[model samples]
Target chain A: MTDQASDLQEAGGQPESQDNETAATEPGVPEAAEKSGVSGKEVVLARDVSKVYGSGHAATTALRDASVHLHEGEFMALLGPSGSGKTTLLSILGALLTPTSGEVTVSGTDITELTSKEQSRFRANRIGFVFQNFNLVPFLTATENMLIAAQFASVPKRQAQDRADRLLEELGLSELRNQIPSQLSGGERQRVAIGRALMNDPDAILVDEPTANLDTKLGTAVVELLAREIKGRGKAGIMVTHDVRMVEFTDRTVEILDGVVCC
Target chain B: MGLAWKEMLRRRGRFLSVGIALLLINLLVLFLVSQLTGLDEGQTGAIRALDSDLLTFDAGVDQSLFRSSIPVSDVQEAEAVEGVAAVGPVGILFGTGRTEAEVVPDELFDMSVFGYEPGSPGEPAGLVEGRLPRAGETGVGTIDETVKSDGVEIGDTVYFAESDRPIEIVGFVDDSTFQLQPTLWVELGTWQELLAVVRPERVGSEPTANVLAVDVDPGADPSEVAREVDSSLPGTETVTVDDAIAALPGLSEQRQTFFTIIGMTYLAAAIVVTLFFALITLEKAEQIGILKAIGARTRSLAGSVLVQGLLLAIPAFLGAAAVTVLIGATLPPELPFAIDTGAWLTVGIVTVSVAVIGALLSFRRISRIDPANAIGGTGD
Candidate 1:
């Protein structure tokens, strides 16, 4: 067993021998491929990535020669305290921020070399992001928010509407599809945001504290729903969180501290 | 465009407030423009309608019609100048007139007395109701149709307040207003007699004329003839008819004042629009970051803002134009309000262009939004 998986099981107070069986049969958790019969392919590869802000005396290093990889059909949890570079690594992986020095390959494209404009296009087409605050546009209804992703991808209006409707229905938000974010509850708004993230059928999803605004019961339920969607569609996901209790819902957990990966 | 429409719909109150302010501003500007146009036409329409190309007056008079005087000898000299086709002496005097009817009191109305030679080009055209006055006709005059409003008609005798001399109304002319006053056309001999009586000091001097309306020969440049006439007749100045109208006392100054007010109103409207959109963009900064992080291009977002501005501004401009036209049409003739399609078109174009420019100014903020802020980090 990998040291990270062993640590995750220990943190959850589960025996190491039962980790594989528990992950495979949890209904929403995907089987840990290293132990299960299935072998997953790597979809996101980052090598020796480093990000530095400012310069000279004012320079602050956010990431220092850190590396990570995400595999298809795997739901990984990124655990770290404040200012530990977890968000920076996730941003670089999602193409929202550029690494000062590194190589990042996602879905067969070296995103680290892409220009700013090209990176935006790459994010639109290949990666989806769910912000911690459930950043659905306040002016748009849930359906419109979901369709915005497809619209940016240049999907035909009719087809985009159809996909948006299907995603909303699958997320059990059909009744609230026409409600603006202000009118929806915290849990409902997060679901709409997740629906928006999946509208373009992106190759990978980057979630930043998706349950930060919810209660414990609701947060666990939301994360379980995300894990089920990620594994069922065979899409890679890297969820950043500080909640160790939520690690049980993920296949692997990696910890970071002080600009360096510890596990 | 879709996003823009939805945002406007969602925040209709805010957008509507801007639209209402713009509408009121545009309405005020259009009304002022109409009034200025009407006042200009009222003050100079008769002079502009003259068939002659230029007018000659005494030089060093600062282009004031009341201050200018040309001797009959100067008129002959102007006629002899090269390129001069025709020359006719005209005299203008402002005086009060009273009808003989008992119902009309003395000092009843103001009138501009135009004295011109019989059968001269200086005579008013479109005489709808009377014949031109003849030379040596002591008590006959042609009155404009506007005099009908004062209870005077053909064959009625109106006497000048200064001379108390009776002049019979023999004809009526249409649209012959001068200096915002009704006109009464009289023979040059009678006008000279009346002028001598009104200003007795001029009775012993040689006959003098206020101006000489000069026509240019066919295929001749009026400006060239004007220069030649000015040089030919010493102590006399010549200017094209258009220049003479512009030189009218208080006309240019009034126009400039109105234009400045209108320009400032337009500028103020643009600033209001700019501040409005800037505030809206400032409030939506977080939403903008969210959109950018979701893959929206800066161009697309900026386009949405421009579209919103145009959508708001165009409808407001059209509404203001409609209201101005309605008010102008229903106003009484004495109110001096006139609006034309050309003026409305100019207002519409300028207003929409300003609005679009204002919206574009907010684009700098949109382009600088950091998408990383939409995430949960320290917005680095």
Candidate 2:
């Protein structure tokens, strides 16, 4: 926990922007949450992260000195419209995209310092991802899809099988374990995707537009399910979405416009 | 590899289309190889089956058995060389043979008449049934098994129109064609008599042979002995059995032509594989992007594509091989369709390897897919 506080102190000096001070003083966010760098025993932290695409005058600054964090047992929503840089921020934190400048730490390991291969390994073992389209491998069954997450982390087959079975049962997908993604409904597929994200018991789960393809009723149901699961498992999560209505399901919401972050 | 298998099983129709295309290509290539082998064997089987270590031909004849003329004295000289065991004179002449009664009046078949010493290295080996011609037997001969298609049997008489002579077929030998014609093996005296009758230009000339087949001592190297034979007998050239087969007329050119065609066919198969996998990769770009985003390595993804290619190629090869074997069994004896195991294995290995290489062409496209694309797309 002290290491996380030190990481926050290091982040405090990077590009002293007003958004950073505002994020630090947001209401209902305890002083401990600020000092611990977002929540108790932070699972993911980003300090002044900036992502610039291209080179020279053609460079497009996708994210500008964005500082963010996720703590265990906390579920936060990154609210933004199109081209608002929330997805870029998510991509950087997930290790799918590299920050042009700044640092990111996940599971207490500094990701920005690792090589591309090491980042891949770290992503496989420490973080999980859920996509808007519910990117389940169309050919694999629900159980197999969940097990693939464990496979990416090199988990033993038998252990992965047991974990996948338990996750499917928890998600109420046990009856549809052998069915492929095409056979599953929109909400069902998202549930399978959620199950896969949790299969490795990762430190942080990053989801992108999870309810974009679902109806309002099903979308709310899925978000509630995600909130319950994140709270029950005591894991950190960040869901990126444009729908403001979905914000009520999360413990906190961080809004973004252009390339700037606002609390 | 597991993921590849699952996807292939799920998309049977998609894979089957390419699989059937591969099957047809394999069949065409394999059948062409079989026919080429059959033609090559038809031309060189007699020389390839020789029990002799070396053969000597006239120096200026370019190893042609028809044009080369070796005097009887050359056989003696080769026999006298160091490390020499025995030397036999071989004579070849083309003629037409008509089987005895129970056949049509003029059902003549092309035949190559070979003259060699009975019980010598030049004699036909592997008699399918019956015995070789008895020493000093003037009018008895052994015929190639292909002659049976002309209804000529052992104990039956074959009349040669060119030589104005008739001989008894006392034995049959298999795989003994020469110049794509059935061969008839007879004693040297009988061959000389027939030669004298057909070509009367040499009524009182000395005996001659088209080539001299030599057997070397047990401890002698055939190549060394061949060199010695050439040095000892000036105006004569000696070569091992393999060299003799390679020197056969039109054989090397025919082989090269067929190999070129086969190589082009393999290139076309590789192109088909490359095109199919590239299209499939394009279709699954979103899925691949998602996989990479979640942590799939480039190596594993590329390996999966190769695995899928092999999955299609191996079964296609097996199916083609089965059909080739069936075709070989049903083909007529004179058609010369032989099933060569070495060629079959080589083709199978090359086919699978080419398919894998072709699938690897898609790796570039897959590696360039940005995980960022998977973020907001509807995945439709």
Query: Per-residue alpha-carbon lDDT of model 1 for B1-380, expressed as tens digits?
Result: 79999999999999999999999999999999999888887788667645578988789998777777887656677778999988888887887777854435544788888888776657667688979798667679998787787778999998765676789999988667787777888888878878877766655568887888898899999999999998888778889888999998899999999999999999999999999999999998988888888888889999999999899899999999989988988997776666757877898899999899999999999999988777774422
lDDT tens digits by residue: candidate 1, A34-140 = 32344466888998999999999999999998888887768899999988999999989998899999899997799988887887788788888888888899989
Name the weakest run of 10 consecutive residues (lDDT summed) in model 1 chain B: B99-108
Pairs in steric clash, model 2: none
Residue B54 displacement (Å), model 1: 1.5
Instruction: Candidate 1: give the TM-score of chain A.
Output: 0.84
Clashes of 2: 0
- Residue A122, model 1, lDDT: 82
User: Clashing residue pairs, candidate 1?
Assistant: B130-B171
TM-score of chain A of each: 0.84, 0.84
lDDT of each: 0.81, 0.82
Measured against the true two-chain complex, the DockQ scores of the candidates, in the order shown, are 0.43, 0.38
Error of model 1, residue A6, in angstroms: 31
